[model samples]
Target: MYAIHSVLAGLLAGSASMSALEVKSEVGRSGEDGIFQSKGIPSPATNDAATSANFKLLSGMADPNGASLDVLHDGRIPRSEDDPRSNFFFAGGSNGGRILVDLGKVIDVSSIATYSWHPGSRAAQKYQVYVADGSAEGFSAELKEDADPTKAGWEKLGEVDTSGEQPGQHAARLSPAKGKSLGKCRWVLFEVRKNPNAGPFNDTFFSEIDIIDAAGPELVRIERPKKVIRQFGSKHGNFRYTLDVSAAPDLEEWCAEHLIPVMDEWYPKIIEMLPVEGITAAESITFTLRNPADLPQNLRGVPAYASGNSVVFNADFMRRQQTGEAIGAGVHEVVHVVQFGGTREKSARQRGRANRPPSWVTEGVADYIRWFLYEPQSKGAEITRRNFDRANYDGSYRITANFFDWVIRNHEKDLMRKLNVATHDGYSDDLWKEWTGKTVQELNDGWKAYHKKKLGL
Candidate 1:
């Protein structure tokens, strides 16, 4: 009986050991800030190793032919069916592509895993991995059409040909196809070319790539991008755009230097303020600076206006940027482009109300975003002591903008966004009641009273 008890204990211990190993190999874990919790796992790159955690999509990630939508997010997971949109693409009917991923720092790389997908094609996945030390002899940290990554002193660590890989995306393990080990490198340059050995229909859809070492995995710290991306104005291409300066030749240089950056910075903010369906049409937004002499007197006084897909600015208004009066005009105009309420959606029930958000509300909304959100330090929306008596919230521009800011700070945190949706889809003052449980008039009166008390008026 004593010998039988000993045997049972030994069996139990072996089962527990097997379970721990399985968890370590299959579940690659990560934490809040770029820290891998792999803890000596055999496959450390299994978790978010290629996406947000262990690695970063650096400056040089591009296909000679542009890759598909949301490359970073799509490439975040290996064949993540959770989001149909999460697949990085290369142009259709192309052979294959290249992408540079930054590991944030130099480390010994023991293994890597490449994951990809295609709808129905059974093209074998043939690829090469080139390791770089993040020096002059490495792949560019900035994306450029003329970039030649091959000229750099990149060492071919290995090649992987998953010709036996099933019809579409399959799991490819991390073992060098050429060299012994990748040694220590900061960037992994992945190249996939059409194999002369395979038949036609060899296009590729890249999913994810992960690099790992024996010590385990560690996430490429996200905040570290500021060291490289900030100087290059990484926000520059947030929008795909085109410029039409045919009308205003004098404004060409200024538009390239100032206008483009401002639009890129603010367009994202406006998009975040709306629901997915509220996105602006896919048409490229044209920025047309009209010749000063041709400008109408009424429009001449205005800095810029959003007309269809175009944001037109008078040459005179472009010059006002020197005095900082029109520094945020692009922001204000693009806000109009993004605010598509009454036009995009209007049922008979909404149209019968025949109530549009007051012109003051729309203009006031623009100024509030410019003054309160974009450049608060400008104090552009301050209701000064001299104008205190006439400072009705309906006065528009700075006056109404001040009231809008108050509502955002005190009552409804997302007032501007809600107000925009309400006005765009058949506006009425009742929206104020729905948002704050008070009439617009009551909110105005309360705001004035608070200001009067604080200013000792």
Candidate 2:
């Protein structure tokens, strides 16, 4: 997408070669964005982003468990990050998915600061903002967007769009008001669109959303990253992937018919991939099928997410899709379950946080297995004529899966499993060299060369 189209692009230009530093999102680093949808601010969004700023305490606002009383009025400006401890929010559905934020009590609101991010093609988000008075409950009741909002119970603001978007291995910032005050109310909603047309992923992420109390703003002194921060995403309890279908009986039926059986079948395979000990997951694993309306807007197009032994699926989304789709998706989610990596592991890595397994690799591991190991017949991970010129091993999903499969065959026999194990237990690209006697860039070079020769370019 960035226009690097020579026949042997990375090889000829050297600029396109993906180095260790070039890899964007790895595990413990991916990223969020908004609101009344849940009782609290979003952090620990399904994607791994966190923090509004890099201060020590209350640094990553909106990160899972990382909210701060001072985030809104602290007066400290937010700069984003790819750290798992970074702050952000997530909304789901298809396009126009949104988050509703309820300020529990009515406070005089003058300005709002909202920030969102994604590391790759998913970064550019188009969104419309709105605010409602305490008298309003939610968008649950339809009101006129064109009429007087106070009389109609809400006021809609102009749309905001992001630029300078690139593969997000790093983070990008989106301004809620762009430094101008938006006179406020008790409730605010951000209706977001990641894509105008359908492709694959389309959830909106919010890294920071604050209803500024600039008049009586709070100040938070800069601090270093600490345990207090990771705790925002710290996990407790055992691994479980339970399926809750109380809302949708049909989804329950489908899960019983497909998801459960396949997950049960793949459990051992994923377990076998993670060779680490002392990393036992929670005993319970749940896969909940939720009503799309009640679920967060971020979960909109997201078919499934694996967190703390639990995986949640967009029930209505799944219900409409085929049973075979759920079965293949089950393999990927279960890998996350087997990953069993958590905040504690992340905290340990923070001491030397340079090289966590990038999100692409972990995600690639999931697709690699789903396509190559589980169902090669599908050719699901094939690199096609259409996408080959721009494809990178870190491009993620099936592309990365195909790359992973190539490295496993040409370099090390156990590359995928070993890489998974290293990432789960705190290892990085150093392991890449350990297995192949080559650095990540070297491996990328070899992989690209293989493709170039195959294409006869």
Candidate 3:
């Protein structure tokens, strides 16, 4: 588990006040880093880029690592958002909890031209630099005394000097080599070395650290302020909460037992699929578990919307509709949350008809993760696409999901990510051409042939 190190509140004195800043990068607008996590690279609600970066501040122990760091040993975390992005990290005494930085859902490593780390209350404690390209859990860390930025490739860029150390503060600079080549990378990790002479470890404090050349984009406020609620996170990577419900004393325990870890399972991969310039996953989301009545007009919040770093949901619907299925539905809504937003709805018929997503794509993709991560066998039951007769890709959730399942199973596994990135326009057989080198008809034919051979269908 990642530990939380507390610095004298000075480090965060101005943190909450620092609004989201975009960092223009060599990777183009789609590749910049530091936007909010809940909001997509470009928000899906208004279908535009509203915020510049996805910046997330997490307590060390509160990190996704504590719950599933083991995923790293398998050479990949469940999703990219699970990757850490804090350029600065700290530890108290020897065994004190740690204070670490994670990028959440931002992109572009080289864009961070310069950075400084000031460890509060110590001249120095041994530390190391870690790196990963989203292929493994934690980081392949490099321990040393200093880091050098001008190097030719990925190596320790700088080191901190902590000889004859005293309590107060210490700082260091990471080499350009360390931050530059990250253009092709995914996550950066750091850890504090243990001190043998220290007493019972308490907490470690951190001072303010800064990044240069990280601002990009302009803010477009689509609507006014409304009531907000959050999904309080748990130690097991389960972010749980009840919105607007009269809290049942047993709700917490019930949620602990039932709330699915669908997002926790998918976030890391989403981060990997995102452009480097975009925000890390955590920075891209604003988890709220509140009621719609708590909101101003009960606008239904656009089904599920993300205009900037914030993702709003109508919790009232979830609670009232509570069932074993709500978990999967919530996961589906959350996919929309992280994907920015779904297509626009101009009318009830349009909402239910033309404006609707193809059933296989819409539901299958969601169920892919929901079932694979939470209920694998049940997911198998949902993968049967009965509508292969396909006129205009009948816009139904279950059927579309089934087709999507077939697409993923028979063709490219990365297809879901490609579809997600391009949903800003629309998803159709044309998308199949762009991604799988086949038309929807061709894909359907191939899928049918493959399945018939396998199941003797």
RMSD (Å) per prediction:
21.1, 22.0, 23.9
Query: Which candidate gets the maximum lDDT versus the true structure?
Result: 1
Instruction: Work out the TM-score per prediction.
Output: 0.45, 0.46, 0.35
Candidate 3 segments whose C-alpha is farther than 4 A from its true place: 1-253, 256-266, 273-323, 341-364, 380-396, 424-431, 449-457
lDDT by residue for model 1 over 1-457, one digit each (tens)?
Answer: 0000000011011111111110011112111212122222222233333454333333333344434434542234422221223345444455556666776776666566554544444323566665666654344543343455556545554455644434444334444333444356676766666544455545444455566654554544212111110111326343555666665556666677776777777777776775434334333466766644345445656778886556778767677674586658888877777764213433443333356688788888888988888889999888778888999889998899999999888899988877776665677777789889999899999999988988888
Sort by TM-score, top down from the best: 2, 1, 3
Q: 98-160 in candidate 2: lDDT tens per residue?
A: 455555444444444344445544444556555554454333323333333334445554445
The candidate scoring highest on TM-score is: 2
* Ordered list by lDDT, greatest first: 1, 2, 3
The segments of candidate 1 whose C-alpha lies over 4 angstroms from its true place after superposition are: 1-238, 276-283, 341-353
Mark the 10 consecutive residues where model 1 has the least summed lDDT: 1-10
Q: Candidate 3 at 235: error in angstroms?
A: 5.6
TM-score of model 3 vs. true structure: 0.35
Expressed as tens digits, the lDDT of each residue in 118-187 for candidate 3 is: 2222223444433233433332223233432112122232233332334333223332422232232333
